[model samples]
Target: PFTLRDKGMKHMVGKNWRDLFDLVIVQAGKPNFFTDRRKPFRKLDEKGSLQWDKINQLEKGKIYKEGNLFDFLRLTGWRGSKVLYFGDHLYSDLADLMLRHGWRTGAIVPELETEIRIINTEQYMHSLTWQQALTGLLERMQMYQDAESKQVLLEWMKERQEIRSLTKNLFNPQFGSIFRTFHNPTYFSRRLVRFSDIYMASISCLLNYDVNFTFYPRRTPLQHEAPLWMDQLCTGCMKTPFLEEMVHIR
Candidate 1:
């Protein structure tokens, strides 16, 4: 899947951006993709074919590593913090980009829904357990009416109150609010569009603050306000196969 995606992306850009842009960096292999200076980027043909011979002789402006981000910024003459780096991973993309370069950073979590759903499921499980325990105790109290049993029931009631308190604590409003942000179909759909716009603008500003880059915004027109089946499946599939199969069989 990654190979196909990369191929599509490489095909789209081809050698065009190379000529149009002031500088073009290829095979970035980001987030430790370029950590080792020994690893060289093999120049690619227009069709994304590798030219290894040219790779070895590649020079500083052409291509080289031990190439720090600061050096790249200075060389590019990027004068301001207007440069924004967009990456999907929080730690690798935003964390490293912001920490190392202080560049404007936009982090994309493609599996936003799945991450939220996983959190919601965990909360639901806790809620279910507490409800079950409380109901069971209530049933037991009604079934037995002896003096000793009634005293036991009173203690159980106190325990039930504590359990309810614990449950409330377990399902905190702040945490629930975050989870609910994703679950609310209306809210997420609106936010997703806004997020894409914000990301693109941020990236554009970083590349060149005064210059305008082509902006192509498409919603892909979801059939329903909620995420479609494929989006959910694609996002959910990011989990380990064992975890996916566990849900699949049930």
Candidate 2:
């Protein structure tokens, strides 16, 4: 049960938060909340008191505690896509409801704000741009057999590694980002997409969209399917210092 006591929510939607939802259940004990069916729902007093009675019918304006998903669905008749559950924790809050019960889940990843902010910076963009150029150069590394050419290729390899470490440290000093490991998506990121139907920096992002707004997933191409920039990127590699060094080797 999210109360509109959060100033962000208060400012975003000018209405009683309770009025926005058919029901609000707090201390849901999720994972277990979705799994176990024994714990009955209890009412919470307006003044933060707990009523231990095992009640059945749910009402608005009154907050409830405990409660399992089985009883919750049976009580509310809110099932499948009609129920969009927002949770900060991927596994504990969203996974079960999405995987087992078929409820649409929205993941709240606050760290996305910081990650995007870093990615938009000039330094990060420069490093990433150069890294792509270096990859194309590396593909030509095996062609040159001369000592000078081999030494230059080694230097490029070292520079690429340093750039990777620098960009990774820009996001986090130790673990880097939860969403990425170098150029690839991390395990956490894979699980995030699997569990959450939609995700954003904050739940308040919904304020920008209409109630009927539909979201579409981006269609990313597979490795065998050439990206539109592949030819241009490889052609751009000819302008790099490595290409000039290769010309000198000849």
Best by lDDT: 2
Clashing pairs in 1: 29-33, 82-206, 83-206, 84-206
Deviation in Å, model 2, residue 174 alpha carbon: 1.8
lDDT of 1 by residue, 1-250 (tens): 2244346655987734345444445646566652434454454444545566634333432433233354454346553357755665555555555555556556454445444454377555564344444445456446788899788778757865665554444435344332243224445445434333334322334555545654444445343444445523322223223223334322
Q: State, as a TM-score between 0 and 1, how close model 1 is to the true structure.
A: 0.35
lDDT of 1: 0.48
- Worst 10-residue lDDT window, candidate 1: 234-243
lDDT of predicted model 2: 0.80
lDDT of each: 0.48, 0.80
- For model 2, which pairs clash? none
Tens-digit per-residue lDDT, 137-210, candidate 2:
87766599899989988997999899999989999999898899997999999999999989999978899999
- The CA lDDT at 106 in model 2 is 94
